[model samples]
Target: MIEDWRQRRAAKRITSGDGRALKRLRWWQLPFRALFYLTLPNGDGRQTEYAVDIPRRIDSEGGKARAHLYLDGRHHAESKLPAAFPVEGGTIEMAISAFGLKRCHYVTTAGAQHRLIPDPRSAEGRRARVEREHPTLSRSISHLSALILLVGVGLNLLQLAEPMSRIPPIAESIGTFESPVRLPIWLNFALAVGAVLGSAERALRLRYGVLDRAGK
Candidate 1:
């Protein structure tokens, strides 16, 4: 029941788009921009292409970014992050995180879900290419990324727990805790940077979870 209400509310947030041609992604924009495409059959049996474009670095004056949806080659609709844009058979769901995109997928009426294809010149596209050309190496790298995030999150939780346990009431109820593993400040900073990169790599593959989101 609650999920249905949330869906209805999201549907209401979608607004029509002005028919503007999408700007080509520039070389400098590769890191800050994300473009995804989905093709589906229209009523007349011709394929209609839909594109979701997000400029991660550019924020509106209100401090929130928007995702633009283009139909064929013209602008179709747009909405804020975590948007649900209605499409031919379902909706295109878009979401972003501090590091990169957390979601860009098509959810179909029959309950199937698929990630949209990334533009060939984008970072995500290069990652996808590696996966295609070196499947084993790609899988190994992905697993390593997950491990890095797990370690980062585990250390963060331990650090948080020690501080929380120091409160007077909490200290009385349970002895103050100390993290067993401690690293130098420089190492900690390095680990933090590594964690961000790992999370970004996972985002390129559309992989996300509580830890990945929290670590970011």
Candidate 2:
């Protein structure tokens, strides 16, 4: 009976602690419809803090990417990849999560003239690694972010449809209003321009991450 109880307890522990590492999702913060989430052992067992911008591009069906890794206030890893590349050129990838530890996967395919390495250490080396291990995953993340942002902005613009539906009529009505109460089209346009410029500035500020992927 004692042995049976011991066996039962051992089985319980094994079931609960399967020993498979996993990334944990802590929280996500979104700015400009861009989300930055925290993880440790969840996405990739990298144990590193990462920032990503899911993207929306016209040429590709989908994409997602690890935007960058946090090193101080700056990003340690960043990439500028076109939305679509001939599959033959290769790929880039990243994984992030929150847990006891972290792991990341990277993979790539080499062309006839280019060499492919299963294990890499340099900047290009790292990029190659990403391509090999997580080609599709990388692109999906990047594409996703852009798609979401574009969709969000589109929705916002849609809301203005009702108000803007009668622009010419509204303009005529405004003319009859007292000079003190009248809002000129030029003034409204200027306000819009200012808001757009402000949002752009914020996007620029979000820029982070620099990878010496070439191992330089």
Candidate 3:
């Protein structure tokens, strides 16, 4: 229903590519660049490779970032953020959030979705490595990220409720309310920073939710 409509809107954002060769990932670009790959059957007893490239940093003047789709290491197509690049078996979808990439997956015609493999030199790749090499530590870190976001959300809602309840129309209707717990200015700033870091960490693992978006 609604999902189909959203998919159609994303499809309309695609545009033809200029057919440039995909460049190799560079050392300096590791921090601010993300690359992912997917392989699918070509229907000729062979397989084809597809890569998605995205720049992490967004230009203030440009407004939004763009995503590049590569086939066999050559540019095939591209679109702005929240893009959907049609491919042989399905569509490769890419989207970003304020902290980092929140979605990068290949949705097949049959409806199954698979996440693309991150480039070995990229931050996502490193996070995947940590998960593979150290399961216990990885789980601990994942849980911590969730805990931080939970605390941030709780405190933020509490703080916002007090001010929101004081609005003229609301105060007259439901009386004024005061926050149960108020932190110092510095503590509030620290919590805000933690919320950002927590969201960024979840992005590395491709985990995002409505609460995270609301916090941002």
Q: On residues 1-216, what C-alpha lDDT tens digit does candidate 3 reach at each position?
A: 997897889788777778899898887887689999999999999999999999876646657798989889888887778888889888888888888889999998999999999988888988999999999999999999888888988898899999999999999999999999899999888888888889998998888898688779
How many clashing residue pairs are found in candidate 3?
A: 0
Error of 1 at 130 (Å): 0.9
Residue lDDT tens for model 2, 181-215: 33467755554444343333223222112111111
TM-score of 1: 0.93
What C-alpha lDDT, on a 0 to 100 scale, does residue 51 get in candidate 3?
A: 93
lDDT of each: 0.86, 0.32, 0.88
TM-scores of all models? Answer: 0.93, 0.21, 0.93
RMSD of each: 1.6, 20.5, 1.7
